[model samples]
Target: MSALSPSAQRVQAVLDGFGLGHRVVEHEGSTRTSEEAAASVGCDVAQIAKSLIFRGKDSGRPILVIASGVNRVDEKAVGRLIGEKIERADPEFVRASTGYAIGGVPPVGHAVPPLVLIDADLMALPMLWAAAGTPNAVFRLTPEELSRLTGGRIEAVRKG
Candidate 1:
């Protein structure tokens, strides 16, 4: 069998754990940005879900915000929802928390259970794609399914 990238492997493990049926697509080059990833996946940029990790106010746990490509996460709103201040997680903190690189963090399968919040805008898209534990790998699914698969709370996590 072929070896899988750490991110891909992690994503696969998560999917398997949840008994989700998904198809993984791998691209030839890096899809580090939403634009690049959308082009590689042949999908609209808005359909791409960006998995972002942020440090919680308590400084002990992390929050994972999955926002749509066309939207920006509202830090204040997220902070209020989580009942704590929030800041973007640094690269070291991100890797330590998710076990994946900055651009490759998946919506699921983190070393710890992050307080997951999904952007409501993503539900507008019929099909959405999220990083599959790797920058070059992605999987297609409905926003609702994605939310359920990740145990994410669907909310207004972003701003236009």
Candidate 2:
């Protein structure tokens, strides 16, 4: 197995915290986009769970939303749910809050616990894949397991 990046290591630690076992695969090229990640992981685009960070309007807290690769986050609905407008967190804010880069941010393992929302659309897939804290690495898990591990709420945060 190849060595994990610092962020990947942190993600692994979080997985360990939940006693979840996962297989990590590292690829040679960029997996920043859904197409790239799907090709690298040999899976359908819908199976990829894209992790997105947003700033909460109410608490000014960081919110992590795990959405399906094929869907887009419904910012307006999300904002309404949080009682404020939702904006994508900038790279600096993302890194500062999650301790991970934009494309490599995982659903778990942040510097602090973030308000997490798991897109219900992702749960339609039997198995979902997500970044393992690095652009070249990914891990697979069930949506229920991911929700349990991250303590995230199941919501329709994404729109088809």
Candidate 3:
């Protein structure tokens, strides 16, 4: 495996601080989308944990949604749950808030602590694959561990 990039290293440091021994796996290229990650990592699409970022329109704060790769987050539902209006955040906003870029944002490391919400659907899976800061690196974690590590509230946020 190649050396972990600075971004990945930051993610590793955060994971370590959490006392979780999850190992980051660096790949040949960026897994920009859940479908791409699923194909590259040989996992079911549903097992890919997409760390989606949104901006709370009312509060002007970042909102992190850790949803199943195959499921689209329902913005309306999320807004209701969090008691704020929300919209999909732009790349610049995401970068400013999360430090990591869109495709490579990790669930644990962020520039600021956003209101994190984990899809309850993700909890049904045994393991989840998520980006490890860099676009080319990733890591695996159990749903329960992910919830605990991020202090995410589990909710049904998928769009029908």
Candidate that scores best on TM-score: 3
Residue-level lDDT of model 2, residues 50-71, one tens digit each, is: 8899997667789888888988
Point out the higher-scoring one by lDDT: 2 or 3: 3
TM-score of 3: 0.97
Model 3 segments more than 4 A misplaced: none
Candidate 1, residues 39-89, lDDT tens digits: the string is 998889999999999999686698999999888899999999889999878
Better of 1 and 3 by lDDT: 3
- Please report how far candidate 1 places residue 109 from its true position, in Å: 0.4
- Candidate with better TM-score, 2 vs 3: 3
The lDDT for every candidate, in the order shown, is 0.86, 0.84, 0.92
* Stretches of candidate 2 exceeding 4 Å from the true structure: none
Please provide TM-scores, in order, for all candidate models, with all chains considered together: 0.93, 0.93, 0.97
> In candidate 2, residue 3 scores what lDDT?
78
Measured by TM-score, how close is model 1 to the native structure?
0.93
